[model samples]
Target: MLNAIVIGGGLAGSQAAIYLADNNVKVKLYEMRPNKTTGAHTSSDFAEFVCSNSLGAQSVTSASGLLKEEARLLGSKLIEEAYNNRVPSGNSLSIDRWGFSKKITQIIENHPNIEIIREEITQLPKTPTIVATGPLTSDSLCSEIKKLTGEDNFHFFDAVAPIVKKETINFEKAFYASRWDKGNADFINCPLNKDEYENFYNILTTAEKIPLKSFEAKYFEGCMPIEVIASRGFDTLRFGPMKPVGLFDKRTREEHHKNYQFYAVVQLRQDDKQADLYNLVGFQTNLKWGEQKKLINSIPALENAQIVRYGVMHANTFINSPKILNKTLQTKFNPNLFFAGQITGVEGYSESIATGLFAGINMLRHLRGEKLLELEAKCMLGALLEYITFANHKAFQPINSNWGIVEKPQEVEKLKKKSKEEKGALLSNIALEYIKEIRNGYFC
Candidate 1:
């Protein structure tokens, strides 16, 4: 019997272990937590979530939502576990972070075919292994990964977000509405007049930012701090993420006048179902907490805003996927070696789990002497893997699932009058059909 070692017991590692063991492959899972700590993780719990509790949107039309549905149809343990312990957050699948990880740890621990090992792995094993060490991988093991992949092949950065307590928000000043009233309008919009926006921008530009540690490189372009975006120009933020387009001010009872464009708008999206916590949408920052409080509260709606969580940025590490892995998520150099999760350069929890399930299935195929399965591009899972494994390696950065990543079918495109929701529903149906085809073949 072949044995497989899975490093890092986060979502990716745990999912990989479950799949391999289900196929009767002896599997060992290694996690470096209470014994070894990452800057983000707070506990020894396997698959600990260092950020927000919500997985992603749950609607089948959304990329993250569609990915969850796909995982569920394919019998994904993570998906099933998430749904069972779900905490309602309107349309999103938010969870109690502690409850979520504990459940996963229990399931993995109870599985007879898998063994859990708690220790920091500074070097790769001589035997076949899957490295799912996540973005906050330790310094020592990162060095070994760099040596194997070649110097300069890996990238690093601090990607941080602030957290706020749900009770601190001033509900009187903020309004709940999604842009264009398109979806559930679940997000809270903090509207700003031109004066309020410009004043806030002035404070943002001059605010003292936390300096990067000597060992840490500058942030990756994808997750650059909001301050950095502001420094580019006063108008940069307005055009970038803070743009107030698609939103109409309900209080004024008038379409926000075109000439009255906001200097900028700060958006808060629901972080959990209780409406107690909301994330500063597009407000990732490295600002010192005191400075953040001073500057952020300057906004009209936030003058008395109680910040429950402060934003943070930390070093993130990942491997060069296009060079090292194939579409099935197995290493080209070693059929028995598999890679999954954030280390594969797929961003977000949903994306990470999707890759894990794919890696697990492929690992089973190798053990059973069956042909490996590679999903079609029309499917969300297939499109994600194809992008990671085939995109131009030199320009590659970690990616979250989005419409741009998948090509829409001609039938959906032909309907000019179809709303976005209608189009999404059509595409979701197609994806489910594709998944059913794969599942039927495997079981039959």
Candidate 2:
């Protein structure tokens, strides 16, 4: 029987352990929390979401959502737990962080085939192992990784958004609606008139910001703090995250939000299943606590909003994957050692979970003397693996799921002029078909 060691209890680590255990492989899962904690984590729960509680868009036609769907089809325990503990977030799959983590921890602790080791791993494991210690990998283990990867590892700062009590929000000004009504009216939108938006923008751009450590000051483009985004220009945020497109003032019977334009809008998604808390969407920040409260109060309807958590930033480390690991996430120098999660250059919670699944499945395949499986490039998981393992090594950066990385199918290419949604639908169908084939041929 095959046995494996999985390091860390983050999303990726938990996922890898579950996969191995379900496949009859004995797994020793190590989590260095509640014993020796990462400064960012507050609990000893498995798969603690230190950042946003969202898992990104929920449409299979979208890249991020497709990755989640792929994991679900493959029986991802964390994804199942996420759905069970889901919160309202329109077209996104957001979960109650505490409940979500607790559920996974309970299940992992009780698994017969899995052993939970609650201690910090000071060095790399010698046996077959999946090193999924995420971005906040311990310093000593990082040193061991450096010796293998040759010091080409990179680090970037990731910021978290603040969450507020639902009752504290002034509902008179904050209306309920999804971006385009794609899903339920799950988002609480606070609209800003031109003057209101201008005042808020001025204050936000000039707000007191937190200072990052000198060695860990670089920010990832995908997770740029709201203040950093606003610094670009007056309309920078308007065009980027705070754009008022696809949303309208519900107080008026507006025509599909396309006919009218607003200055800006701040959206909050439900942070818990009870609908008692909601997190500011795309409002990740590294501002001082006082400044964060002040900045949030400047927005319409949020003047008395009670913040449940303050936004903070931390360093996320990822290796130059293309140069260090193969498409299967196995290190070139050490075949027994595999990498996953944010550390492998795949960003976002769902992407990290996808990599863990691949690593676990491939590890099982390696032990079974079966050929390793690789999904077609038309699939989200396949595109992500290709990008991380085959992209330009020198210029490689951590990547999130995006259609740009997906390879177009021949049928999709034949279409002369297709809308983005139509193309996405075609690509999604192709990807799912490939996944079905994979399940039947390999997983079955």
Candidate 3:
């Protein structure tokens, strides 16, 4: 007789279920794996980490660490179990994959208010539901989601360029300008001479690439990875993504006076409203992270770039959250329905859990006819949700929990000349204090 249903027992779904069950809300948790497996999953366990065994750094100075601390403050069941089932990983919260999965499975199956259902939910239920089906969501449910959100808002593949914190990008070597000076000076242009272009080109062509999974083998001609384009020929990238056509570097041109002209240029577009983050304009890549760092560093403008999210070209199923969901993770189309996890355009283990944990709390509130929590952007989890819900929909991409996403608290804004670690510690302190206030004030 449970009216509340949580679909797809992944990280987000599982966290949502646990939070709701702990609050005495009977939850029917559904898992589709072992009955209908995804391309990545190897087991039927709830909260199974499909990718990395390491969650992230456990130090509060790190972004993932701040999220975990806030989750701990909010009594997150998954975060507690992650630590309890953790293995030796130094400062990183790494765990024994099998043991962690089994522990989580045991907990979910034994929870008194939870009903473990071994089935696939193809249809979105009319009753209150949280669709945390994740990136590898099933075809049928994908279809249902597509119908609910429309085809334009749903994406089956992720072709994303690396995003860098604007503060880290060496502006001395880069200048903001629009192509042909036709629009606002919106693009950060990194002008590369012949030597720099060739050097970047050589490294990119030889970089290690992650072979697409069997299910993700299909490559669209127009949207091939940057590495693939480089492999075609030496001049391919110069004419393509790295093209310098119409980009008149007015700043450097004024300094050099017609002596400086770019052989090729790399462009970065403003990714956030704050303009604090910018993404490589056409740098959608599948290169290994090590190689990505090497190639990005070769560019003069990106010599010391701090990549917030790396370029990822993978078979992923995520909705355009800014277009479809509120900051509460509830869909704009249906108030009774909610979404969390990778499907909500949030990447990483802790981030998925944060969304699910919040959705669960908000779902319970929704059932009780109370105002849902739209956590303030000062908190790590709140900032992530705010980004997904309010980011530009035209180029919305999945993001992990990164310091670049968190807003500076007004109190922190007053203080200046602090080291990066010190600034991060200050932000973490603000987030923890904010979450603690919510935990104390909220009834559920």
Candidate 4:
């Protein structure tokens, strides 16, 4: 019987361990929590979502959605669990955070072929291993990784948005609507008129922020703090996160103002099955506690909003993947070792699951003395791996799943199409065919 060591119990490690265990391999899954917790996590549960509850858009025409569909085709264990515990967020796949983590912890703890080890691993094991420690990797292990991959691994800070109680939001000013009314009216919107928006922007830009510690460098472009974004200009927030296009205020419409539109809107996405908690959409911040409360209260309907959790920032680290890893996620010089998740430079929850699935499948092939497998670059998953493992080494950075990484087939490229949704649909169809071929030619 083949046995493997899996390090860290975040999304990627848990998914990899489950995949290997289901395939009849024994897995020792190490989670350094409860005894040694990352500052962001509140539980010892595997696959805890420390950031926003969203898994991004869930339509095939969207890049994140396409990546998720590909993961589903590959039988990603976490994606199944996420869907099982989903909370409404229009077309995006958001889950009941606590329920989702509980289910994943239960599954990992109960697996027959898996052993849950509750201890921090200070050094990488010599046995066949998968390192999915994620961005908040501990200092000692990070040092060890640096020794192996050189001292040039990159670091940046990521912030989490605040969560508020649903009851505190005033319904008189807030209404439910999704962008372009494309899906169910699942998102709660707080409308701000031109004057209200201008006042909010002034206070936001002038609000005091928490200074980063000496170790934390620049913020990741994807998760820049709301205040940092506000500092760009007077109209930056209006055009960026607070853009109110493609949405109508139900209250205003009911009040006989058919053509009325707000200057800006703040969105709140449901974060739990009970609908009692909602996270501020695109409101990640590192402001001081007092400043956060003042800024939040300044919003039209959120004057008395009860904050369940405050926004925070933490250092994110990633390996220099192009120089250290192969497309199969194996260390180029040490074939028995592998990496996954944000630690290997793939961002977003769904992207982490994809890398975990690939690492698990490839590890199994390695054990059986078979040729290590890699997906064709025509697919999103393959393209993401190809970029991380083969992109220019000197300019490496963490990346989320996007269609830009995917290499387009000639037919789509020849048509001179600029629509992302159109290109995504064409790529989605081709990727599905590749999935069918992979199933028939390999796993079958």
Candidate 5:
């Protein structure tokens, strides 16, 4: 029997292990926590949710949601477990962090073909292995990865958002609505008039920011700190992430007010199924907790805001995927070895799980002496794999799954009258059908 070793028991590693074991492959899963630790994780459990419990949008029309559905159809262990433990949070799939991790750990431990090993792995195994060490990978393994992939191939630093408990929010001043009637009005909009926006902007610009450690200075472009966005220019944020276009306040019903479209708007997205918490949309920051509360509360709607968690920035690590791996997620240098999750440069929980499933499926193919499965680019999961393996090597950065990366149908593009969501739904349906075909073959 072929044996597979999966390093790091985070979301990616756990998923990889489960899929491999389910296929009748013997697997060893290694986790370095409780023995050693990262700056982000607090528990020793496998697949720990370090930041937020919410996985992302739950609508099939949204890219994140569509990815989740794709994962579900593929019999993704992580998504299945998450769904069963899901809490109510509007249209997003959120889980209890502690409960989620505990459940995953239990399942992996109970699997007959899988063995859990607790120790810090300083070196890679020469035998077949999958590296899904995620962003907060330990220092020693990172160095080993650097030697194998080359110095310029790895990265470190992640901009994270603060999670707030639902009970803490002052709902009297907040209202829920998706922008322009999109996605079931799933987001909570915190409206700001001209004066309120200016006041909040001023505080944000002047508030104290958490300084980067001497060793970690450069920030990833994709996950820039909110303070960095503010420093670019006063209106920089307004034009960038905090832009208030496409949203109309039903309470105000003043769509064309011209001047007060919103000096700015801070959106809080539902973080769990239970609506017990909301994450500040596009508000990832490195501000001190006190400063975050002081500055964030300056907004009119958040004057009485209560913070359950504060935004933090941490060092994230990844490999130069385009130069190292094939679409099957196996390393070019070693066919027996595979890579998955953030370490492979794909971002977000769903993206990580997709890579894990791909690695798992391909690993099974290798063991069974069958041809590897290479999905079509039209599929979202397939497109993500293609992107990581084929994006420009020098400019390749970690990417979250987005519609912009998916291969668009020519028929959809030609229709100018269709809304973006309309086109997205059509493409999503096609992708799901393709995934179903893949699943049918595997399940039978």
Candidate 6:
């Protein structure tokens, strides 16, 4: 049997270890969790979701959905585990955060071929290794990584939204509905009248925020602090996350809503399997804890909202993948060393799991002395790998899976003839076909 080392028990590392162990590899997985803390995490479980529980949409036409589908075709362990612990979120893949991590922790701990190490690995290993330490990497291991790459990792700040007790929300001001009636009423919508929106905006923008001097880093655009987003403009929130389009608050009749339905709306997504907790959608903030509680209380439907967890901001570090990694996710200097997840400059939960899945696959091939497999350029996983490993290293920022990164059909006339959804369907089919073909060859 072959031996492999997996560092970090977060999403990526856990995925890599599970894939390897299932394939008959003797693996040692290292996690520095309860013993060492990353300020963002609140649990000791593997694959813990520290930020939002949602993993984007599940439709194959969507970018993240397609990436997840591709990983599923490739037999991604964490992806399956995610679905097993999923919650109701319309078309999106939201999970019971606690259940998802707990299941993965149990599986990893009990695996026969995998040995769990409850310690931190401060330096890179010379053996077959996959470093999936993720974004919140410890300072000591980061220094060791820097020594190998000779480049400082780019740092960004990620903000998490606050979770509120569901029963505390005032039903009179809030209603259950999904946007455009796309599915059952999976989202808790808090509609705001013009005056109420104005008041909420004023309070949100003026709320005291924690000092940024501690991190001294710029916020990732995808997870910007709500207050920072508010600073952009008064109407930015309305146009962005708080947009009131495609929603009908049944309580307001057409006669009463003759002019407009609502000025803005806030959405809270279900967080746990029991449906007792919901996180403020797109309300990631760095406000002081007291200010966060006050802000939540100010929402019309949340006048007495009980906060289960306050929003927080944390430092994230990622390597410059274009400079240091090959398309196979292997380090340029060491074939035995590969980096996965956010550390490889790919963003989002599905993207992280996809990278780790492929890294584990290539590691198996390396052990067999076979050429590392490069996913087809037309596929979702392939496009992400191509973008990160070949993009301009100096200006590279973390990226999520999007159609723009994937290879597009060359026939201009065909594309012009199709609607947006039609185009997405065509692209998805192409990507899936490629991934399915790999399935037979790699796993059979």
Candidate 1 runs further than 4 Å off: 22-25, 85-90, 182-185, 213-222, 248-263, 391-394, 407-426
Q: For model 6, how does the per-residue alpha-carbon lDDT over 110-139 read when each residue is reduced to its tens digit?
A: 999999999989988999999999999999
* Model 2 accuracy (lDDT, Cα): 0.88
Instruction: Give the alpha-carbon lDDT of every model.
Output: 0.79, 0.88, 0.81, 0.89, 0.81, 0.90
Error of 4 at 349 (Å): 0.3
Winner by lDDT between candidate 4 and candidate 3? 4
TM-score for candidate 3: 0.67
Count clashes in each candidate, considering only residues at least 3 apart in sequence or on different chains.
13, 0, 0, 0, 14, 0
Q: Residue 441 error for model 3, in Å?
A: 0.4
Model 4 ranges with Cα > 4 A deviation: 254-259, 391-394
Clashing pairs in 3: none
Best-first order by TM-score:
6, 4, 2, 5, 1, 3
How many clashing residue pairs are found in candidate 4?
A: 0
- lDDT string for model 3 (163-273, tens) is 788898888899877666764676788988888988998899889987765653544344567887788898888789888877887765777656455799998765543
Model 2: what TM-score? Answer: 0.96
Give one digit per residue, the lDDT tens place, for model 5 in 1-444.
889899989999999999999888999999988888887787899988876567887888888898889988887999998888876555778776667788999989899999889998899998788988998888898888878877465555667787666665666667777666655776777777777777777888888877776674656665677888888988888876678876667766665664445567778776655667777877878888888988777766677777877888788888888888999998888888899998888888888888888888888887777888888878889888888999576678788878888888888788679987898898899899999998898667
Candidate 6 accuracy as TM-score? 0.97
Worst 10 residues of 2 by lDDT: 249-258
Predictions: Cα RMSD each: 3.2, 1.9, 12.6, 1.5, 3.0, 1.4
How many Å off is the CA of 293 in candidate 4?
0.9
Model 3 lDDT at residue 39: 57
Reference-based lDDT, residue 320, model 1:
81
Model 4 agreement with the true structure over 1-444: per-residue lDDT tens digits: 999999989999999999999999999999889999787898988999999999998997888888888888888989998999999998899999999999998998889999999999998999999999999999889999888777566889899999999999998889899988888999999888889998898888888888887874767677888888888888888888898887897545767566666789999999999999999999999888888898899998999999999998888888989988899999998988999999998889999999999999999999888899888888888888998988566788888888888888898897575676777788889987897788677787
